[model samples]
Target: IKQLDSLKIDLSKTAPKKENLYFKNGVLYKKGILFAKGIEKGRVLDQFLKKINFKPKSVIFIDDKLKYLDEVEKFCKKLKIKFLGLRYGYLDKKVNNLQGFICDIQHKNLKKIFCFIQLNRNGYFQIVIYFKNNKLSMLIF
Candidate 1:
């Protein structure tokens, strides 16, 4: 919360605009950050659109979970909004301790770990990760 509070928008320097970008999540902020309770992931954006009275023609939805991404993509298609889905992956360029990060995620969240690791076999590469019981069981490709 402290980190987010520090990153809050500097409204004094910027002029009010009709279009605004927001980070939707489970926690609600008093400053009007969009919050979606329960397991409804896509409804946050739906309610946000209605709250602002804005109808967008196109929207790009990026997420780590394939299921949630598919849900949002379908909703956007139903609304006639252009949709682009991006599967987020985590890669380290200058770090050698990738496994440490994976272990941390598994222990901390006990939820979906969307980070995909690339493995090379016979000069061919593949993305692999296993998610079960709210934990990352394996990461190999």
Candidate 2:
């Protein structure tokens, strides 16, 4: 947080319009003459949307608390606004959240390797492993 101190991002005393939205009383409106001030928390939509003055069908409240979500649900019902909950609820089925994969072969310190298995003219099966250090080893499997 200290690194961001030099950015000089100052919020004015009034916070200009559309900058920090104001939802005073039951009736909604902005404070400034232009759309540059005030903010819409429900959608974070643009000025074109605010100018249209259209009632929204749904509103998704995003908060880190379950109690806040419950309160938002009640508000949505009273305003005739559909509510969408974006939460990671308890899973009904078991899920595996894996990040990486393990190789089928078992070699740990190898940076580069080549494997070749071939049958010689004398009917002998020979397997060769060429390592990164230009070292070659032959094995019979």
Candidate 3:
């Protein structure tokens, strides 16, 4: 929301007049935008549809992953809602083409700082670290 505000984008006109902004469960609603975390996209869409009083005649869903798009498409079919699922692969292509590497000295430093570091064939890195509270955190980049 803050990022949208910074860009001077006004979404109020397209948003529902009442109850347009709120955070419930793992979903965040701000004007015309809806964002969900820690949940499947299809489930999130289902939740959103259930909350609305009217059923939409059609739904257009776009996702970078075909798995998610397929889930949503199946859900839409169950409801008999006209559906269009677009699979976007721009980010996937970019990530796959990326060249990620660490110098010998950098690798040594990372080994000292992290509990484990694994570099995958796609040049992505996964790191595991232990905190002072004995909590384990894993990060992928």
Candidate 3 lDDT at 40 equals 71
For model 1, give the 10-residue run with minimal summed lDDT.
119-128
Candidate numbers sorted by lDDT from highest down: 3, 1, 2
TM-score of model number 2:
0.28
**Global fold similarity of model 3 (TM-score):** 0.59
Clashing pairs in 1: none
Model 3 C-alpha lDDT per residue in residues 1-141, reported as the tens digit of each score: 654789999777766443653447768665767675656777777777677654678888887668878988888888899999998775575467545443443454553454655433334444445343455454443
Candidate 1 per-residue lDDT over residues 1-141, each given as its tens digit:
333569976433332233344444543423434344444546666766775676777766665557778877877877889888886645332223333454465566454656544432221233445577766565442
List per-prediction Cα lDDT, in the order shown. 0.54, 0.43, 0.64
Per TM-score, the best of the predicted structures is 3
RMSD of each: 12.1, 21.9, 8.7
**lDDT score of model 3?**
0.64
Q: lDDT at 30 for candidate 2? A: 42
Please give the lDDT score for candidate 2.
0.43
On lDDT, the stronger of 1 and 3 is 3
Descending-TM-score candidate ranking: 3, 1, 2
